[model samples]
Target: MSLRRRMCTVAAGAAAAPFVLVMLPAGVANAHGYVSDPPSRQAQCADGTVECGPIQWEPQSVEGPKGLDMCSGGNARFAELDNDHHGWEVTDVASTVEFSWTKTAAHSTRDWQYFIDGDLVAEFDGGNEQPPFSVDHTVDLSDYSGEHTVLAVWNIADTANAFYACTDVNIT
Candidate 1:
């Protein structure tokens, strides 16, 4: 095309760039995560088994300050996971169980820990690099019996925070 027309086309493209950027969502908005396997309390809500608030939309985002025992990851918005009367769905498994997590934003992992009735059952080093989009860990549960709650924590290497999930299960 002619030089003038070409210049006009370039100017139009430049003017539209800002609009395109504005239409896209922010990156920070997608930086949280949650567990799904065995169905965390928030995951139960995400799957429509239980009615919950905003956590139903972001089940993997139960993030909070590390070292806290709260199940909602210390965020009051997701505190529903901490409640025992929500009638959360339970899973039945053998002496061993598999724990999994879905990572939306791969932050450097510090460690992955599992607890049963407030006692540490399993733990693994998360390394200093970002984990895969999905992670699965096999934990030995031969020592426990009957039913119990499993609280899994994914600690971030670069932050004093962690992602939390709780799953109720019956051992066979």
Candidate 2:
């Protein structure tokens, strides 16, 4: 090939490289799940609703060993989500509130649990199929009024790990 032709081809390839890359899958590049509704603390940090650090970059990555109530999925980098004094946003909700989880990557979910003041208030069987992009559950909060913190747990169906999220809410 001629020198000029080779240079032109190389430049053209370089110019189109980014566009090509965009079409391919990111391949497990980020968090598999995060609560987007009522905005989990990590999600709030991710969207700039609250000022934060590294957790803001990967909100759905707070995964840890199963059967635990600690928030941030046992990941210390996102421990800020467990701190209510971090100036987090409080979502105003009704007697019945909807909890939503946004899945970046689908997985076979075992169960979904919601806790208030360290007590399990609601639990949903995940079933056998892989969860969808947006999974939601209507939780009755009649027993809970005023400011409360909800710790949500997403247990993996086929693994020993689970994802965790926390949201502060004001029920009126």
Candidate 3:
């Protein structure tokens, strides 16, 4: 092509460079990943039941994969909490505990129970048509101190089966 036409082509390509850059992934800018330090993976119990990490109260974000099951008794693709593990230190007995999770798909009903040092403290009821939800609970912890574990037992509402997730417990 002629020199003038080549110059015009170069100018047009330069103008489109910014748009192409914008379309590329801005890695690390908005990336979301599991909060677990060691990256918790799915595990199966002696009875062939799968469980996830011993989560703590630490502030972190995790993204659930597509078709992940939050229910119990089946081969769920996501992580489940270990009810027996506290996962953190308890320093303040009066501080309120907050627990949250996201569901990608809607469920008929979801129920969650909170336990502090193995004691039932609160319960949440997620009704039908609710896909993703969260909860914040404040409980008086003046009766205890030291390291403790806060467990969240979740299950389908009206069902006896349950799954657990945990966060580090500290009462100051």
Best by lDDT: 2
Candidate 1 structure quality by residue, lDDT tens digits, 1-172: 9999999999999999999999997553334677788788888999899998899898878989888777888899987889988888888988899888877888888899999888899999987777888999999999998888888999888888888999889999
Q: List the global CA lDDT of all models.
A: 0.86, 0.87, 0.42
lDDT value, candidate 1, whole model? 0.86
- Looking at model 2, the pairs that clash are none
TM-score of 1: 0.83
Q: What lDDT tens digits, residue by residue, belong to model 2 across residues 101-155? A: 9988888888999999989999999895687789999999999899998999988
Clashes per candidate, residues 3 or more apart or on different chains? 2, 0, 19
Give all TM-scores, in the order shown.
0.83, 0.81, 0.42
- Over 110-131, each residue of candidate 3 has an lDDT whose tens digit, in order, gives 5556666567777666563333
Q: For model 2, give the 10-residue run with minimal summed lDDT.
A: 25-34
Per-residue lDDT, model 1, residue 166, is 90
**What is the alpha-carbon lDDT for the whole of candidate 2?**
0.87
Candidate 1, residue 101: the lDDT equals 88
In candidate 2, stretches whose alpha carbon ends up further than 4 angstroms from where it belongs are 1-31
Candidate achieving the largest TM-score:
1
Stronger candidate by TM-score (1 vs 2) = 1
Model 1's C-alpha root-mean-square deviation from the true structure amounts to: 4.1
